[model samples]
Target chain A: MEKMLAEKPVNVNEEGYLLEFAQWDKDIANAIAVEEKVELRDDHWKAIEWIQSEFKKDSPLSIRGIKNSGALNIKEFYELFPGGPLKKASKIAGIPKPKSCI
Target chain B: MKNLIILGAGTSGTMMANHLVSKLPKQEWNITIVDQYKTHYYQPGFLFLPFDIYKEQDVKKEGKKFIPKGVNYIQKKIEKILPKENKVQLENETIPYDLLIVATGSKIAPQETEGMNGPNWHKNIFDFYTYEGSLALRNKLRDWKGGKLVIHITEMPIKCPVAPLEFAFLADTYFRKKGMRDKVDITYVTPLSGAFTKPKATAALHYLLEEKGIKEVIDFNIDRVDYENNKIIDYADTEVEYDLLVTTPTNMGDDLIKRSEMGDQLNFIPTNKATLQSLENENIFVIGDASNIPASKAGSVAHFEAEILTENIQNYIKGKELKEEFDGHANCFIETGNGKALLIDFNYEQEPVQGSFPFAAIGPLSLLKESKLNHMGKLAFRWIYWNMLIKGIPIPFVTAKMTKKGKQITI
Candidate 1:
């Protein structure tokens, strides 16, 4: 669905992840971050940047991937984003949430 | 005759051997399959094994019984695969291959988590992903005065993803049958956001958790097992205490992938998801849980992949363009206790929705809804698995690629 983010129409899914990465921008991210109750700081952006880069490469994101990325340890990752870090950070970075075949 | 070697005589490797043995011209290709073990385990039976729903004899048979007469079967440890050399290193012999199929599947690595395989291993802490683990759990449950029964998943990409949930369901049934339903506190814990990976499934099946009184602990990225305290501590410092901990530990591709330096961080080989051809080399193909495909690591997925892979291998041999036809198709029966189960039919593009299967509005087997017929199908599957599935026989009405005929995708 198209919704106004940073005063611009951005397409997102029901869960608020961006449908197209092209529609993602810094202002839009900050807007979504506000909705997710996450304040975008340097530490948060580091993880978000790493996540978006991985998504662009079509690499499936997982907690395991984050642990191995060398950008941050898992403990600091949880602290940076709080609660469900991977899903929250991916939303802030405008990538699809990680999923497994059920 | 050129040699076509298959590593691992498990489901995928054995099916490949059966598939190509008749298709590959006898005068042109010699097929040989290798595995260190003699037993071909009915892996799905591991779920029922703990509840004593299945016996050891029912789940295992001689691996040789399944391999066709023409193919050579070697029971020996595989040392490594020298992929660049197009050769495989066995314990004492190095065999060159015109084509190599890697089916060395995934297994549980309890040691991947600290304190998982520590002092209390197999005593109270258990895994049912293996025959040993299942049998050990069976013995443990035989006399187990139930406490907090924690059914956990240490990480994702584990084989038979639904088995853990089924374990929770069956545990409820088992305890009820034993007249000790209240004696056990069943908790389903996962690293995923909910009881299921897909949103629709989570929505469709959330009632099972509520109906059976199974507590859920989601988004739990476990850091270590506090074995001394009988607690699993996550990165967030959240702890879930358990008396009887049934955990599926970190599942990884075989260490041979690591030794050969041919796999990703999880040791799964990178492969073309559609063609089943290894991305790194054209002559190499991977199937089953060994490849890092975004599909459930289950026998059903392997069965579907075997059909597409057989065609692809023949295409590669015939110098034809490979068909990008594998659509990440996976069909599985989710046992939801009380002589009922749910059947889910899905592919890369389709989420399992409410409908009939293999026929539109005429399903003897309903999709995404719990039914007793589906439960019967689950029981009858053991026979099909042993008699037909591993023999490369096409299951009636099931296709290599999923069909959208009977599905209600509008939801």
Candidate 2:
């Protein structure tokens, strides 16, 4: 957490915009492990890491990938936070407010 | 009696309406103006609206207030035009005239982009070009806790090209005032190679952009908005995600021009280089954004055109030889925020040369130099636009022709 926060342009909260996708989404998705209900097993972290690796050059994560990471389906994952991952992740990670921002 | 019909009540049309009312013999010609909107906006103020420099009410007034008496103002949407028949078809009635003037200004048509006007419009993605968009952005900014705010321009040929830059500067100031400047990251995205159309202005503005710590992303040809993924992707595979996206959509001429036989591919009327008369049909004339002139599409250009065209129209009506006169002069006050601004004056033949305006070397506000005096001068223009410009009163010290006396001739 200290290392991610220490890195330049890593905090989406600081820039208010997401310059890189892997850093921005993963910033939020990685923090999901800290949440009380979330149990980010190696498989879940692997899935997010996979999405980041493929998408570092501009590939974005798909909803189907959540299942590949051994997490629930997209709907069940969204059911974790009423605000949903896109909105919650974006706000927490400091990605500029996407269309889904409440 | 010869009928003169103007197909808009915007800044240009209203100015022309007042000028013609004063110049033409009311006994000889009846002037009729058509437009759908009842409220007249100080369009220059739209740039200030999002930044809280100007409120919606501050820049708005009833359209009929500035309209001179004896000129009939009809609030109606124009459907089509038959230039060959010298007639305009509006929703309520068909206006037939001896002289027709098309002054309907251009507008942002995001629908031209495949995914531009999708579900994310005005919600996640906002445009500050219109009154509603600016007002909505004001609201969005108020509630914003602070984060990556992207000020993006879809394409150029937009009215007041410097407005987006002004927005970035003002946003920096606004967020700072709100104690969120530390958290806010402002990035300016443009398709242009520089911050401005001119090299000099870009160099000067680049310093300001750098001083403000605003990230600059140049030559971004945006392909589409992936709303599901929350990112704006370019053709070259560069994706910039944002918390909020402020975009200026593609500006195009009015639909009526397309309906008429006189307009170009983008629905802009093809007018003579010097004369504002329609190239396809001489009886018809177009000014302001609707006209496809090499001149910058601006209110100042329209004001200059109105002055020159009035004389041309009078000469044409008298069967006298038309003059190859108008030189495409356009001037603008670029707001640089912190109560300071810069002024740019140029014409068709000359680029925006670095020099003071009007008085030249001895200026209260420096030319091509940013200062508080220019900001105050810009603030004062609102009063001038309402009292003098729209009323057709000739602005002293200004003319249709570009004067080289005060300007530094560029290479």
Candidate 3:
């Protein structure tokens, strides 16, 4: 495997999900989203913002939680991140991977 | 007392044993469940093994543990089923039955595809249907540095139809996390015209595939697997090359069904789709993947069919009309990776629609929509399968019949 060196190194799990929530920032989140091939729109930013806040509060992050948070509806949430909405949204939001994501 | 023999001590067979043990009169009938193996595998857990979401021990349990107290559990390979004589031929002896339940579920036949079982069988070509196959694939993925990964389904009627789609989605997430998403060229190949069997779900899934940057090759009937060339050839002579192939090979009923000459061309016993009764034999009933029904060949279908079949079996014993009719009620949680999943509930007449499930307006779970709750539901199902389902304990609110109460019909 080729060495993955970043200017601002981030600790991630074997599957690449974020391990430490405190280490996340806008630059790292943007980089992750770019790798996921998702162009972050305004709504995407809202999802990321909500997820990060929820993580800070130690609240459960879910599709329903996102929808209930008024950040995105079910269709809009799926449209914003496509496949694996919670996983991708969490990654881009710079939060630890959800327990159910495995 | 008369013998009521059940073939295959798998999911359906075990469930039937638990159900009939309490319902049937022990004085008039003796319940017996037969199989060749002693381990009962939670088959759905196989889908998560390749991704390391589930471990080997999580999906396996002692088969005898689930067999009810009053029922006789026999561990023997069935040689053949003599339906005419109302007897089953085992390796050493023959056992006669007044009533028989065929629950010998389907098996993946990799050899049916040319070159599939060749030198690259477990090396580059792997199937996640079996326990060993899933483990091998997991080991292979650990060192795989991302190349052309193709997930293909050879034919339809495979157990858990949405599993391949789940694999594709999970692989995308897996590679992305491995920091090699750009290096891997992921593709999903299927015999169907769309990503799934149903129409509405197909459209939604197609969009998800495009969003994930995973190429989808549909309606491509695979004719052969070119192992040396590392390519899969379709009947139309189209070639799809792959560095690694995760395939769901042609799934067929047990070999005993074929030897007995009581099954269709695919070794599935022909049965009344509504009644679950064998078409050629009155005393025989086929459940799970062993039946040639229009419904999806899935565990949920079998779970629903068992409820109806149990009632019908009781009715048969009492010389009463078999009034229970199964409407092919099936529900599945489609795992879309990254900790989110979608729930779908439908029957023979209605396709999956976007709506709340079990209730019309108040749904803790959404239908046809991906959610974290659905993912939790999928994960929690493992516990339910082991405890409630096989024990014949009725799940509250979720009945065998499909209801339109919470479903919105969409054209």
**TM-score to native of every candidate shown:** 0.97, 0.78, 0.80
**What is the full ranking by TM-score, best candidate first?**
1, 3, 2
Worst 10 residues of 1 chain B by lDDT: B196-205
Scored by lDDT, model 3 comes in at 0.83
Q: Which pairs of residues collide in candidate 3?
A: A101-B339
What total of clashing residue pairs does each candidate reach?
0, 8, 1
Error of 3 at B407 (Å): 0.8
User: Model 3, which residues run further than 4 Å from truth?
Assistant: A1-102
Which TM-score value belongs to model 1? 0.97
Interface RMSD of 3: 17.6
What pairs collide in candidate 1? none
DockQ of each: 0.55, 0.01, 0.01
> Candidate 1: which stretches are off by over 4 Å?
A56-60
**Tens-place lDDT digits, model 3, residues B85-172:** 9999999999999999999999999988889989999899999999999999999998898789999988756778788889999998
Q: Give residue B206's error in model 1 in angstroms.
A: 0.8
State each model's CA lDDT, in order: 0.91, 0.73, 0.83
